[model samples]
Target: MNIVDIIIKKKNKQELSYDELSFAFNSYLKKNIPDYQMSALLMAITINGMTMKETINLTDVFIKSGEVYKFNKKVCDKHSTGGIGDTVTFIIAPIVAALKIPMAKMSGRGLGYTGGTIDKLESIPGYKVELSKEEFYNQFNKIGLVISSQTDKLVPLDKVIYSLRDITGTTESLPLIASSIMSKKIAAGATYIVIDIKYGTGAFIKTKEEANEFSEMLNKIANHFKRKIRTIITPMDNPLSSCIGNALEVIEAMEVLKGKKSPLKEVSLEVAAHIISMAKDISVKEAKELCEEVLNKKEAYKMFEKWIITQGGDLSKIKVSDKIITLKSSVSGTISSINALNCGKLAVKLGAGRLTKESQIDYGVGIKLLKREGSKVKKGDVLAELYVNDLDIKLTDEDLKLFTIK
Candidate 1:
């Protein structure tokens, strides 16, 4: 019953029962279990790995640690496992909601290079990211869409364990990753869930093989919980969209919703189609057609505006910094690639993201790609623009190395 025995049992690669997992987690939450012991157990779990049963048990433990939200109407949700310039949520939520599908999403904040939906939303002035239980339900009932930050009362244990795992070098463990992600999605009460698993130099999963394995594990957990799920594996060697900051990305999403053709629009539509297919019991092809219809007719944009207004977000208040540094091509050639990881890091330096949890985000600062991969450019042609409010934030030659032109 003690935490020591549970830690020892897990360290030996033995399966932990639900009671044992729950006891350890609740004890940790209550300050009975020190972080060092929890870190040891997490490392053991990462190296030894957990069986499907253990993962499910741990996920259940996370869910039981806090309140699980319930909605009067069936709701859908989508999650992207961290990526650079991945602004699909902004486009997907409104598109699905425009089709009469309710989407209830709980997003996180930017921590490292990857952008977060909550942070992106908060870039808009007066946008409320934290909502009470009553406000959440009322918003869902009123607009059929609610995107907010995770509250302390919802899957609070995941927050504690996630922070520990982040620093303990156990963040890459498959079972731990599955349990953490599924726990939050499940606790948020989404009847249907769509997950975008990105893999490449810029994503957490480094290869297609690992992404597939993670996908299988996620599917197993979804099946066990009887939640309809779809997982999309996408490459992330290049940024998903041309925008790489908070307000800038939001602007790009609005452009896509307004029927602009870009990589962001393609990925967003595919993800939205899958969610619609599951929620409405239609084929993905049919769902895609519906999505295009909505976008072409500007229905999605209308919904985006309504959702923003309902959530108290002011579009006019979203201002990108006027201090711009244009990055130009040095040689006349086509763009071979845009290093997603490097772009993210450069954006972080521009204050588009946070170096730490408490780091302040400069909502107006970010990068805008003027030309994407495969575009031909002449010498001196503008490649990208860096937006900054800080006079000292200057781009170096190394920063220009993000775009590989030949």
Candidate 2:
């Protein structure tokens, strides 16, 4: 039962049984297993990979490490693997809740290139993220919606393991990624989980093949645990929405709910449709139609305003940067492409994203895409706008690389 033996077995590409993996995690949490040894095993698992059983076992270990919430209705939890300008969660929660679906979501904050739902929500002044369990249940029961922080009691071991993975350079391991994500969802007590798997330069996964593989693994593991899961693989060739900052994204979400049509609306509707279809046992087509109806009638938007009020978020107090700069197109042709990753990096540079976990972000800072992929742009047409806290934030040639024209 020594941790070294488990490490060696995984390092040699051998499957560690449920007990072995469970003991390892429990021991790690108890401080019986040191990080260097655990890190070595994580790296080994990253390179050598894990079998389906091992992946499931690992997920089970994480799930058993914490408390699971119980609700009267089946909780419909939607999670995105995350990408630049990803503000789908805000729209989906209200839309589905407007249709009477119960959505109790526990969201994380932004870390690197991707923006998080909680971070976006917190951009609103006086918004409270840490809700009491009573508050969480009351909101869900009364309004059919609740989105809050993941408490220390829910999958607490994941914090330690994930932190180790963050610094050990082993975050890309498929099994680890799948188990890490699925474990949280499982522990959260969601009856149905919808996964938004984005792939491309702007996403965590880089290719369709890789995204598919990740989705398949997630599905397989979900089935093993007897939990239901659905995945939507979308292209992140461009940002999901025109807005890429905390406050900016919340503003964009509000605009979408108000019936302004954009790429964000299109993708958010699609994801919401899946959630409704799965939770209600209706066809995805019908679910999409319902989502649209809710948005078009302004029902979802009203729900959003109500949800914000209930959660103590003050929209009027959300700040927007006064120093604005517009980057216009130098030449005209249909926009050939918008490099998603570079665009994300540009937002990070503009003080919209964090360089480290502890880094502070200017909620008012972000980028707006005036000319998206395939849009017609004449010379001098405004391509994008940078909302920055500092006046000296300049766009470089590398920044221009985000916009490619024919």
Candidate 3:
């Protein structure tokens, strides 16, 4: 039952039984195990990976490490591996929530190259991200959508383990990633879940084959839990939106909420529609129409407003400054391609993201791309604009690499 022995067993690629895993987690929670030994065990698990039995055991271990809130009503959510500009969650949840499909979303802080939902909402003046179990259940009972931050006490072990995974070069493994995500969702009591699996230049899984493999594994795991899971593979070759940072993405989500016509706006609504349809078992067209009604009729915008207020975000006087730092075209020609990774890097440089999990982000500092794939541009056209809360960070040649106009 001791962790070192379990670590030694797993390091040798031996399967750890469910009881052993559960006892290890229980010991960790009780402060009987030091992080170094636990980390050794984690790294061992990463290198050897986990067997299906072990994966299920790990799932159970993390699922019970903290309080799991269950609802009698069916609840669902969607998760994406960090991508360059994927802002689908901001738009998707509200639409599905409006449809009376309970969207009990619990999100984390942004990591590495991707933005986080809590960060985006915090850009609003008075948004609240943490809700008590009572508050969460009450809100879900009322509006059917309760998007909140993962509470400090919920799946605490997963939070710590996931951070270590990011730092230890263990993020690329499919079983680890799948288990990390599913554990949180399982702990959150999502009866049904939709995973938006993406692969391209901009996403974590850069090949379609990799994406599909992970998608199938996720489907298999969800089925094991008797939870309905739907997955869709999308392209992240380009940033999913014109906006990639916190407040800037929030601005784009606002436009979709307000029924504005833009590619980011369109795609946001499009994904939201699919999530709604999949959760409710309706046609995409019907779902899109229902979502469109919420947007076009201003209900979606209102719901976002409510969500902001509910999460303790300030809405009044929340304006994304359009007065921007335009990084223009070097020469006029076809755009040929844009590198999602480079753009994400520049976003981090511009203060939109963090290199370390501990770094802070400027919600205002990000680019809104005006041009996308297959576009011809004139020299000096504003290709992208940097929104900065601080006027000091110098935008340099390295920051402008993928933005080549030739």
- Residue 194 lDDT, candidate 3, scale 0-100: 77
Residue 354 alpha-carbon offset, candidate 3, angstroms: 2.7
Question: Model 2, 257-355: lDDT tens per residue?
Answer: 998888889899899999999998999999999998999899999999999999899988988798898888899899988888888888888888777
Minimum summed lDDT over a 10-residue window in model 2 is located at 162-171
Candidate 3, 1-406: lDDT as tens digits:
6788998998899988989888776777677887677778778876787777677667778877888989997788888777877777877777777666778888876766777777777777777678888888887887777777777678887777666565566666677778778888888998878787878878778899989888888877888888888787877888877888888788777776777676656666666777777777889789889988877777776776676666667766566655477778878998888888888888888787766657677777787888887889998887887777666667778777766455
Q: How should the candidates be ordered by lDDT, best one leading?
A: 1, 2, 3
Instruction: Tell me which of candidates 2 and 3 scores higher on TM-score.
Output: 2
Off by over 4 Å in 3: 1-16, 19-48, 319-324, 389-396, 404-406
Q: Score every model by TM-score.
A: 0.92, 0.92, 0.89
TM-score of 1: 0.92
- Cand. 2 Cα-lDDT: 0.86
lDDT of each: 0.89, 0.86, 0.77
Which runs of model 2 end up more than 4 angstroms from their true locations? 1-9, 27-39, 163-168
